[model samples]
Target: MYKKSKIALAIGLSVGLATTAGAAETNWRMATPWSGGPWLERDAQMFADHVNDLSGGEIEIEIFPGGTLGSALKVTNSVKSGVADISHNYINYDYGTDPTTALLAGHSSGLTPEEFMMWMYQGGGVELYEEYRRDMFDVVAFPCAILGTEIFLHSNKRVETLEDFQGLRLRTSGAWSELASRLGASTVVMSGGDIYSALERGVIDAAEWGSPEMNRPTGFQEVAQYVIVPGVHQSGGFLECQVNEEVWTGLSEDEQDNLRLAGKLSVFESWLASSYDDLDAYEELVSGENEIVHLDQDFIDTIYEETAKWEDEYAEDNEWFARVLESQRDFKETMSAWPEYRLPIGTMGR
Candidate 1:
């Protein structure tokens, strides 16, 4: 009877392998919201390389640069409906799909770049959507890339004070736009593609687009006279990885593990890489090639404090925001020990 049981178990395992073998190639299509510039191209390539390498060519994802397959909006929905196998986008782009999806997108909430990373990875924030983000979006939640922190105010007009934002036509997205409206600005929602023409043509006086390297591709240099620092609107933001559900489910346990590891590494890469870019951009902006204006440091301190208050108040109304904030704050506290352990040793080595 024991031998019979062993034989039955072996047969079941064999059948499972046979079923997986009969499954089709785990090929996928992947795209990002922004045009496939340096970071996007590198990230998409990393995903393809790692997945293909780990899967032994069983799973392949063809990279589509911006608008090649469809818009950023379409990409998210496409992945959801299994029209696409994977996606790289800001989850906040799908604010309509579910408010909670925006948690990692980093539109609001008083998260610094490191805090946001910690919150998403160690803070139990992503787990809140383990069902919807992991299942409904038909993908695993990989906090793949971070745009660093953004500074608000790329205005056609000078915004010296919060009151100066009143009646100013500005381009924004996510819950932060609502906060901008409350503060004074008339918010005009836009896709990333539309921002350039709108700002150039004076359709909008100001806009907030981060990622210093990415903005260079759009010729924001040509039109927008001023770029302010300390992005009050987006102190931090993130890019989400939405793996194709069927393709992911088909992956062996080892392959799934590699994909996740790859995602976390990608986020670290983004974090390290963008810090350099911001410094470089700031140097260029101040070189007088561009008419860059720095907001007063005092003003920045004020912005940070006020936004924190706004975030708490905003959380009061939105249950999702409240949960995200609490989760993120907890993550930050947990990581307080990390700086002591990691930074000092690294600096000594350097």
Candidate 2:
């Protein structure tokens, strides 16, 4: 009888342990807009890996690259609708759903990468983002990656002044396209895959894609001769990770915290890795056949002025845009003291 009782007790304990483990384990699908082999895609994967490690295997996430699950632009919708448990994407991709997202994604003459980080993490930007996503899409969202300044334009025609943009055929998107039009350029919107062919065929005079590291692999140098500097359109940008509201709510508080930490870690690592790679890519571009054209300061100032006017006009009509724009401008003003206090620094290797 004693042996039988001991056996029964052992069986009960094993069953309880199994049940607990089953309840703790969770599997999720993460959809991203980035294709394979780019830092953007790797960053999303890294976040998933970090979540798995941090959660002690309690959670596992699988990454689906761009177009694998659905249209990249609809990733947020996929997550919200449960097609994907989570998604990694740019906030601007949802601009059609809400114009406020354009400002969230970083605009011309907006926050630099460092300032944007400070604004997002410390200056209530994260809370605002969460509020916006929750109300707009019924999802939980946070920035998972921060990218540095992008290349202004890769062109066959030289563009140094505002006058040079006159009648120039440029391929771009979002607010930049509008700005380009305002500057007298005939702007065309096309996918990144189509840029090289368009440039080679003289269908577009110029195009703005990404930073040096991100653009090099696309072989822009082989087709475009001029590499313009200072991407005023997108000085910096944020990639976000969004979770389905139901999935987020189902997680334990500890699991939720782990996901947030994983995102922050991914952001830090990706920023450093991409920034260093961009430096190397820039050096290569300088030595390669493509001519580097630095936009004149006067032209850059004119762009800033026009950007301010564009944002102000949009903000006048959009309450959320106004609020976000106010927050960013306030942060920029508050942090303006640092540049004055510190000694001026030159470009790397200058």
Candidate 3:
């Protein structure tokens, strides 16, 4: 009787797999926090297109740009609850789920986006991410978009030194906010959608949204006159696409492979597009109306010093955070050496 039961269970599993295989197509709903901004939004669209093409229309992803379904910050929950099958969103917004998320969600890790991607793809970063995700959230993840280093701060008033940050009300989030608070700035957390009105109403004296390309469409320049370069707070980061675990597991192997490939393609596409967009947007800011301010090197050095201190303290208290942090530090130490000796392409005029 026990052997019969085992055979019956195996047959049931085979039937379920066969039924799933026989399905003609699968439709998925994808949501994003942004209002379909050019960079991230474009990447999402391309990813969807790639999946469709690769799977021969076996998988169709309908994107809901902006917080049309719910608050942007609620994306992870939305996916978990099956309200949306997937989310193309920033991990920093989900740091509440697990503080270790900051390790990937734009900590001041001193690695540029390219370097971070290298660590993620080749140096065990993705494995670390998957371990954390399994513990903290029920979703399958992929790094769908990668951004260049951002313009650090945008202020209504000119800010050039560490002294300028003291008592300043800055709108930010994640690790950067923590670092800024330690540097004597008051940090306020708000959605990117809320920043404009807040800036106009004096709710925040300064903000650090994203790259100039991402910010230009929001009209930050209309209100903030000073634009600080080289985002020391967030050297580089990725926008991830996370799918519900059930939905991800339900897909066939080929379908799963297509999604993975699409995500990787999106990363490469976003990187290339952002380079051009950032260059043009930055030139416009510098030559146009706003006062372009470069942060003092000494002040930046101090910010890094403080960032290191925070990392040490946090790692001591949080094992997961330390695990990811130590791995990245180990990878970056040797990786950084290559760029230092190579051609000065990255340091030509800067």
Overall lDDT per candidate, in order of appearance = 0.67, 0.81, 0.79
1-350: candidate 1 lDDT, tens digit per residue: 00112322353344433434554666678876657575567655654555554444456777776677676666776676666677777777777665555556776555677777767677665566454576455566576677666757677787766656669898987776766777677899987788889989999998887756566666776788877666756778777778767767867775567666556666776677777777786666677456566666655565556667766875888776677667766775776787676754225655
Report the number of backbone clashes for model 1: 3
TM-score of 3: 0.90
Q: In angstroms, how far off is 207's CA in candidate 2? A: 0.8
Candidate 1: misplaced stretches above 4 Å? 1-25, 135-138, 296-320, 332-350
**Global lDDT for candidate 1?**
0.67
- When 1 and 3 are scored with lDDT, the better candidate is 3
- Which tens-of-lDDT digit does each residue in 34-120 have in candidate 2? 775454456777677666666555667888887877887688878988999998888888877777887788878657887788898
Candidate ranking (lDDT, best to worst): 2, 3, 1
Q: Relative to the unseen true structure, what is the Cα RMSD of model 3? A: 8.7
Candidate 3, residues 24-66, lDDT tens digits: the string is: 8878888788775764457777666666656555567888876
- lDDT of model 3, residue 304: 85
lDDT of 2 at 105: 85
Name model 3 segments beyond 4 Å from true: 1-23, 346-350
